[model samples]
Target: MRLMIVAALTLVCVAPAVAQDFTAAPNYGDVRLAPGFSPDPHLVVVQAGGSIDVDGTLSNCSGFITSAPDLRLFWDGNGSLDLKVSAISNADTTLVISGPNGAWYCDDDGGDGSNPSVTLSSVSGQYDIWVGTFDDGETRSAVLSISELSSF
Candidate 1:
C-alpha cells in the first residue's frame, strides 16, 4: 500500500513538467547603415509563419558606399524559404547573404540585383540580405525583391 501511494505521488509530481512543452520563434530585421552616398535602406518584419514582399533600390552606390544593404528574416529554424530579386544593369552591384551559424556569401560586380531565388539549404532560422557597390567612386543602382515560403 505504501509503494502504491509513493508511485501515485511521483506521477503527480512529474506530470506537470512533462505537459509543459515549449517552442521558440526566431527574430528578424536589418542592420543600420553608416554615413555614405547610398541612402539608408529600410526593412519590414513578418511573423514566424508569415511572408514579406520587398521592393527598393540600392541607389547611388558611390563615394564610401562600400557596404551592402541589410535584409533580414526570422523564423522557427524549420521551414521552406524563397528570396527573389530583379535587376537592371547589375554590372556594378553586389549581393551579400548572411545566414545562421555565421555563414557569409557574396556575388561580385553583378548585373544589378537581377537574380533568381535564394533558398535556405539547411534548417532555417534568421538570414540577412544585403547589396552595395565596390566603393570605387562609381554610382550604381539596382532593384530588389523577395518571396518567402514556410509551413510555420
Candidate 2:
C-alpha cells in the first residue's frame, strides 16, 4: 500500500512536466478558413514563446509555448491542397500545431531564415497553433501566416 501511494504521487508530480495541453482556449483569437479563401494568406500578429517547455514533450516538437494555444484555426475544406502554417520574425522561432486528427506537428527552421513553417498534407479541421522561440523564456513579436499557396 505504501509503494502504491508513492508511485501515484510520483506520477502526479511528473505529469505536468511533460504535458502540453492543446484543448485550452487560445491566447490570440480563432480563425476559420476554407480552401482558396480570398485573402490567400491569412495573417495574425502574435507574441511567440511562453512558460511551458516543449522539448521532448512530443516527437519533433521543441521550444517553449503557453499552456493555451496562441491561435486556433478551424479549417473547413478538402485536402486537395496542402496547408502551410508558418511564423515570420527576426528572432529564431518554432511552430507547434495540434491537428484535428489529434496529431501534433512541429517545425524549426523549415521556413525562410530563422522562422519556422509546417506544411500539413492532410488539411481539414481544427489546428491549435503555438508560435515559440527556439530559446527558452524568450518572447518576441511575430506574424503567424496561414496559406495554401506559400509560406512566410
Candidate 3:
C-alpha cells in the first residue's frame, strides 16, 4: 500500500511535465506498446494446460502452459500497476511476469486460492504475463488482471 501511495505521488509530481502523446515515455524502457493498445488495464482470462519449457531464471514457476496465451501490458509511466492472477478452478496454478527489463518474477498461492500476483511501482514500461500450472498435464482456467492504481 505504501508503495502504491509513493507511486501515486510520483505520478502526480510528473504529470505536469508529461506530454499528451501516447507513446512510451522517454528513457522509461525499450518497450513502447503497439499501436491501438489500450492504456487502461483490464481483466483477462485464458485457458491453460499442457507443457512448456521452463527457464532457470524463475525460481518458483512451474512453466508456461502449452495453449495458454501471454498478456501484454503497456504502461506509459503514468503511475503504478498491480498485476494479479487467479486459478479459479485449479489450486495448482503459478504465475510468471516478465518485464521489459528482462527480469521475471514468479509466484504461487499469493491470491485468494493458489493464485499469484506481482506489483510494479513507479516504472513506466511493458510486460509479458504468463499463467502456468504446477503439473505437466494439469489444465485449468485462470484470470489475469492489471490495475493502474494511480495516474496522478
Candidate 4:
C-alpha cells in the first residue's frame, strides 16, 4: 500500500514537467528550405517567453517557453550544411530546439548580447523551435533568425 501511494505521488510530480509538446502546432509559422537557398538569413518576428519552466527538464535547458513550439522548420536538403537558429531580443532570451533526430538542444546567450543561438551541423528534416525568456511568464518581442552563415 505504501508503494502504491508513492507511485501515485511520483506520477503527479512528473506530470507538469512533461507539458511542453513538440508535436503541437507552432505559434508563429513553418518554413521549408533547402541548402544554398537564397536569403542567407530568414527572419520571423515572435513573442518570446511562456509559463513552462525548462530549467530542470534537461541538461543545458533553461528559461520559460510555451507548451507549443514557436516555429517549425522543414529542411529539404542533404545533411551537408550547418544550420543556425537564433533569437534577437531586448530582453534576455533563450532558445530550445527539438531536432529531427529526436534530440533536444538549448542555448542561452549564445548570440550577440542577451540573445540565444543553436547551431546544428549537417542537418535535415523537421526542427521544432522555441524562443524563450530567462524569466518565467515574461513575454518580449524577438526576431528569430535562421541562417547558414551568421547569427543575428
Q: TM-score for each prediction? A: 0.39, 0.91, 0.58, 0.89
Error of 1 at 81 (Å): 4.6
lDDT of each: 0.37, 0.88, 0.53, 0.89
lDDT of 4 by residue, 40-109 (tens): 8999999999988888676778999999999999997666678889999999999999989989999998
Q: Tens-digit lDDT track for model 3 on 97-138?
A: 666576766666666665666665535566656667766656
In candidate 4, residue 73 scores what lDDT?
94
- Candidate order by TM-score, decreasing, is 2, 4, 3, 1
Clashes of each: 7, 0, 0, 0
Top candidate (TM-score): 2
Which ranges in model 1 have alpha carbons more than 4 Å from their true place?
A: 1-69, 75-77, 81-91, 109-119, 134-139, 148-152
RMSD per candidate (Å) reads 17.9, 1.7, 15.9, 2.0
Model 3 residue 56 CA deviation (Å) reads 4.8
Question: How does residue 61 of candidate 3 score in lDDT?
Answer: 56
Ten-residue stretch with the least lDDT total in model 3: 18-27
Poorest 10 consecutive residues by lDDT, candidate 4: 13-22
What's the lDDT of the predicted structure labeled candidate 1?
Answer: 0.37
TM-score result, candidate 1:
0.39
Q: Cα deviation of 53 in candidate 4 (Å)? A: 0.9
